[model samples]
Target chain A: MSYNKRNDGRAFDELRPMDAKVGIIKNALGSAMFRIGKTVALAAVYGPSELFPKFLQKKEEGLLRCTYNMMAFSGSGTRVKPGPSRRSREIELVTRNALESVLDLSECPRAVINVNIELIQTDAGTRCAGICAASMALADAGFKMKDLVAAVSAGLVGDKIVLDLDYSEESFEEGAVDIPMAFMPRTGKIALLQLDGEITKEQLREAIKLAKKGCKQICEVQRQALKEKYKTEE
Target chain B: MGILIEDKQIVVPGEEVAEGMDFLPAPGTFRDGDKIVACQLGLVNISGRLIKVIPLEGAYMPKRGDVVIGKINDLTYSNWFVDIGYAYEAALSMKEATTEFIERGAELTDYYTYDDVIVAKITNVTKSKSIDLSMIGPGLRKLQGGRLLEISAQKVPRVVGKQGSMISMIKEITNCQIIVGQNGRVWISGTEIWQERLASEAVLLIARKAHTHGLTDRVKAFLESGSKK
Candidate 1:
């Protein structure tokens, strides 16, 4: 069976509407909130301060640690567990790797920069929203970064390639393939690429192309959110 | 072939600041191929052929010769550990703790017990991130009775103004003795409680508006009106 139309009525190449804002958490070194469709991610950055448990400290560069969590009632299906789970741990590691590529931490040797992302609501693209929010929070904290990382999921709901799969599309009765990807828009570097289901080589390539185009737009929103925090009064 | 951003305009990481080799990349920016890209979220500052970004916020990196306010966190027989708002705790040895000689094994708490706030100077910062502090310099002493206010470390220079004009103006008007630490810790003492409160409010106002133009005049007017109010 062929999937001709998106569940949410969005075009094949269009993403869910996104909203982002920075400097939301005053006490944090830097903070941001990103919402794509029904998923909401709040990210806060702290440190480049001391790294404890001395063994983990790197003398050459600072460490980037990320923690991803979903609130108890954030999931569209059922209640999420309150604490860390295996899925959350894996997401945390991937999120850290996604952001570490653009950060320059040599000046902060033996220190650690922590990015905490909490999903206030989830509709399918929780990790992608978290990464986008974390990237803005890092820049808002004034960290030296080579570039911002923008992420979104592009995949096949049945046989049709689509950008930013929503919950309905993710759980489509027909087979669905979700590929969450992150990119450095300026350099066109892929920071993250994870596929959940199988797809033909040609379909995978087209999905990646769509994801990159979506990432470029997400980067623009991230830049605007950072600039908005420091907008001068007229 | 030219700078892409106007001076004083804010730019974010990876944003192109200049497109040609005519501009030299400075700190907070780096050369990416033929382009000078900003690696920080900061205001672009162009001087002659040099292009740099002045960061608006970040954690304070301790530097030698910087006077900072710290609270005593721990004490050994000969050394006191001071929290100078940095990642590493600074060591203030008995020899550098005061002008008067401190005998070995002397009761350290008598001089500076835990949580005693002191204004000290950074003597040395090692590559491993260890910091050495000295309390013998002028204006370096344990704060007696005052309120402490913390602002962003990056705004300390603005609070001090050019050649101490801004702080001096504040001190004269508020009738308060104000000491701003490079680590963003501030100590303000006044004969009247209201005077101390007013001085703190002014400092905070300056910190909030540090990026804006005409801050000195605004601060002056704020101090005058604040005094009257």
Candidate 2:
């Protein structure tokens, strides 16, 4: 398939328009709706509540449960899987850890936090995007978080390492190995890291830096959405 | 109060971004090397550089002291498990659900059944996430013969505003009794159907455009224009 030109015709580093809403779900402890260009995600945060299995219950902190799903019609091509898959499981773990890094779990011992990420639309970098959306949703739910978690994906296409990978670039780019990473941009700390394909050590370092930059930008959007959601409070 | 940036909203502690710097995107030291930059502020830690913003700590957290609006998802054994939009279902026992002592053999459907909207309180949240709800509170009960609209839960506070300012504004204009469920379900009723409809529309508008600037004027204008003819 032939590739279509981007709207701005800018080089690969630029990002598309983003729309984010915090606490979109009425019932969840926290929830958020995030849209980046054609890709969209709805994330809900529930927890600091009782744990189910007696053994699974922790005495030190709350347990984090994350479920990531892409609706059947959320993507193009053959469509996404209906139930949870290995890919979904991986995404869930990554998201859970990313969120765990920022949350103060000690406040809710023996409790659990359930984060559900629904991909309403799939463009690219869904895993990283999902983590970012889920963290914002968690914050919106008013959970005690030490910091806001942010994430972005970068890939090596040809000789260039692009930030915020889109679907077309992820599939069509030659020798592309996508790296979806989650980080707390404020602390310059890594929460979750997964790299596919291969790159030189220098390229990997560059990729991490670029990914951090992208995550920082995404964090700004999350912040903006929260402000909009809560501005009326006195 | 926080700063509003280029119509996009942002919140920072008094020490983070100065008053003027927050109004413009990328107006402060965050600019790229020699590149004019614009970005909204997200978080602000004690050290001060822009960070991800966390919500202000509040008292309510699906607790026993608050009021909520919820929908009934299922009914069983003279009890109704209502979906209050919380993580767990709120079990409204037959006794707490209504004044009468509902027996085990009673027809649950005759009382609050599936898909019914109710206003209730969290009587207890078990260590295992099981929530016990009560409908016997002052304003708690089954919402009979009315429609419930769901909005984003985070926007509930904005719609209600500080000290019920926003809600009072809508009530004064539409002349309707609007019961706001902390969980984001709004129950609006009025003698005139059109008035109730108008108020619902107005509340939804506020929910959508709450992030925009000058919301007070915009909402007042919307209510005024809507009430005319």
Candidate 3:
């Protein structure tokens, strides 16, 4: 049966409510928290400092290292393992790739900027939320960047296109096709795109267009969060 | 020629600061096509034809000729590695460590041992970020029996205030000798412990409210109030 309505009562092209905040982690150089639906991601940026082990040091540019993790009780289905898992490692790599394109780290060669993303709660679109949080944290750290990254998940749930799939939509009775994408809003460049499950070419194109609109909204929220940190007290 | 943002307005990375070629982009901002964009999270500063953004926060980037307070972290045969709150540890050679020269094999620890905090000047910073420090300048010496307070490096200017006015006032009121490093390490020493604490409190206040208006007066009022208590 074709899905007629969203599980959460949101429109087909509508996104889940988003909340973003920066400078939440006092000890870190930069930090942010991003929440979409039930997924909550906190990202902290540390260093342009010396990279240990010596071998990982880059002579031309600083290294952007990302670590993505989920708390033990963050998962909606089951308890997550505390340490790094294969899935988490893959997300970390993708998160780094998504943010590295905008950063200008040439000034601090041989240094490393570490971005640690933790999921305090999860529904679906965990990786996308992590990327969103990491991007804001990097900007908050005052790193040179061309633009901020905004990410969202758009998918084909049954026969209908949906924006920002929550847990229920992701686990639709009829198979769902989940596509997580990130974009540089100013340049209209794609930083990340991942697809899981099958969809027609026409449907994929439609989903991407919808995701771009969602990402634009997310970019605004991210920009507002960064500006909020430095707003003069009235 | 139009400027997209007002002067002193906070801007984020990739935000457009100006829309015309008439404005030249300065540090913390970059030219992107015809537009000048902020590459940092900072306040826009427009001076004449130059538009720059003053960063609100970041790790301290080392610059030459800056007086910094550093701790001796490691010692080799020829140099002492000083951690100056930067990405890399700086090298302080024996030649730069003291004015008087001695034998080549002399123990380096006699002048600056492990964990000794000293006020030094940055002599050189290589393109690869290797820093060289010198302690031969006047007022440069090992800090003894003083508490160290660390703040964001960006707030050093406010802590020092205009023409060293803010720091001098704090020192005079608290009766403490205060040295603020460009790296944001502050050394406060006084005849009495309470005086040192007061100086530290005042400096911390300046750092905290650096971006606020009329900060100098507020700091003075705070110091005067503290002295009376």
Candidate that scores best on DockQ: 3
Q: Model 2 - which docking category?
A: incorrect
* lDDT (CA) per prediction: 0.92, 0.71, 0.91
Model 2 vs. true fold: TM: 0.60
Residues B1-229, model 1: lDDT tens digits: 8989999998999899999889999999999899999999988999999999988888888899999999999988779999998777899988899887667666778899999999999999887778999998788999999999999888899999999999999999999999999999999999999899999999999988877889989999999998997
- Candidate 3, residue A209: Cα displacement in angstroms equals 1.6
- What's the lDDT for residue B217 in model 2? 80
Model 3: per-residue Cα lDDT over A95-133, one tens digit each: 899999889888788999999999999999999999999
| Model 2 chain B lDDT-worst window of ten | B32-41
What is the TM-score of each candidate's chain B when compared with the real chain B? 0.96, 0.71, 0.96
Q: What is the C-alpha RMSD of each candidate to the true structure, in Å?
A: 1.3, 8.7, 1.5
**What TM-scores do the predictions have?**
0.97, 0.60, 0.97
lDDT of 2 by residue, B1-229 (tens): 2332322235421113324332222321232232212222223321233423322422134656557888899887767888776545678877788887776576778878777777898888665446788988688877776557877655677789889999999999889888888767799988788888889998888876755557778888988998896
Number of backbone collisions per candidate, in order?
Answer: 0, 8, 0
Candidate scoring better on TM-score of 1 and 3: 1
Candidate number of the best lDDT: 1
lDDT (10s digit) by residue, model 3, range B1-229: 5899999888888888898889899999989889998888888999999999888787888899999999999999889999999888999988899998868778778888999999999999888889999999899999999899999998898899889998998988999989999999999999998888888999888877777779889988998998888
Q: Give the winner by DockQ: 1 or 2.
A: 1
**Candidate 1 chain B: worst-modelled 10 consecutive residues by lDDT:** B99-108
Residue-level lDDT tens digits of model 1 in A92-175: 989999999998887778888899999999999999999999999999888899999999999999889999999889888888
Residue pairs with clashing backbones, model 2: A27-B85, A30-A141, A50-B127, B26-B39, B42-B53, B43-B51, B43-B52, B43-B53
